[model samples]
Target: MLATMSTFELIDEASDLGQAVIKSNVYQHYLLAKKELQADPDAQERIRKFNQLKDQYDEVQRFGRYHPDYDKVSTDIRKIKREVDLTETVSVFKKAERDLEALLNEVSEIIARAVSESIKVPTGNPFFDNMSCSGGCSSGGGCGCS
Candidate 1:
């Protein structure tokens, strides 16, 4: 059976994945900003520090499955929330949320298509003349099910 997860759990997993993406984006953005600003040392260093924190989170996210501290990620999120002022984190988190929402929409459409494709109808057969099949399989033999 496919593992069943609540919507919240799925959201959590996607958020974790998004965390990595957001960190990379911020780091790249920081690098660009640094170059454009002609090596503004303080700004570059600050972004670098922030990127490192995000990187640390990404590291936990990447290898959590292999460690006893697998649960540390969720705990770490709580810790960060408690320790850091969230004025900045929200926008980053919001961007991640939006990205995740878009991806989930695409995933949902794909799953819907897959489900739509899975329902197979039998071939044309005179047996189903009166079988009420929309496929025009009307015949007295009826469906093989008969």
Candidate 2:
């Protein structure tokens, strides 16, 4: 027979899992990359400019194509976004961030599957989004357990 955990014990176990994740290589890499990105003044300036232009783009979006500055803002944001993305520190940080996110998603899926394969785990991946139905439910919409 399997032993059941009390609520406090479950909370403790969850905390332990969180600590383990923080100690993981993926998480460590993410932190180091983030730190490097923050320390890079050029990258920071590019990111700031990109965000400022993005805010302008959001405001212009309210008017759709009618806004006079809409096209300019859109073009500027795209250019700055490319610059930000091309920065070595930012690129490394983004990859590390994605890696960390994937690791967390995998852990969540494992825990959810351990309880029941039918339990829907919100994996950020679009490919596996529809694969949550393991019990042979034929519905294309999803497991439809909700």
Candidate 3:
């Protein structure tokens, strides 16, 4: 019963943390930017056009045929890609995605470091903590050589 209660408490705390993340300004902006990206028809069309051109090029490569218009298609694809990249909605959405990704990465790293620290195994010198010996040491055991 005690173990179960503790588990529930931990879950509740995690849920609260998740709620806090969702309420953060960064997360809110990410949601808004994602909505803007979804609602922009011009941005969607540009992305679709780029995909179609890419698929056509892939098909040509798959059939091993020398496509006369390959260069033209590639150029068009690049142009559409550039235009889509320059679109405000797309750019905002990408920035928001990167921001959210960075936040998540930081959270993950913090969690990982905390967990690792708690369960850390001693590796002799903390400063030169390499798991394996490089075997390049002039004196066998001095430089992490077992």
The lDDT of each candidate is: 0.51, 0.84, 0.74
RMSD of each: 20.9, 5.1, 9.4
Worst 10 residues of 3 by lDDT: 121-130
lDDT of model 1 at position 54: 70
Per-residue lDDT, model 2, residue 102, is 84
> Per the 3 Å backbone cut-off, how many clashing residue pairs does candidate 3 have?
0
> Model 3 over residues 21-126: C-alpha lDDT tens digits?
7998889999999999999999999988888888887866664536777677767778988999999999999888777766665565466566774433333333
Give the higher-lDDT candidate: 1 or 3.
3
Give the TM-score ranking, best first.
2, 3, 1
In terms of lDDT, model 2 sits at: 0.84
List TM-score per model, in order.
0.22, 0.81, 0.71
Per-residue accuracy of model 2 over 1-146 as CA lDDT, tens digit each:
56567877988999999999999999999999999999999999999998888889999999999999988988888899999999999999989988888889889988998898778666675554443434444466565633
Of candidates 3 and 2, the better by lDDT: 2
Tens-digit lDDT track of model 1 for 28-103? 5544543554444444454555556676667777776786665766576565554433434433444444454444
- Name every residue pair that clashes in candidate 1: 127-142, 128-137, 128-138, 128-139, 129-138, 129-139
Clashes of 2: 0
Whole-model lDDT for model 1 versus the true structure? Answer: 0.51
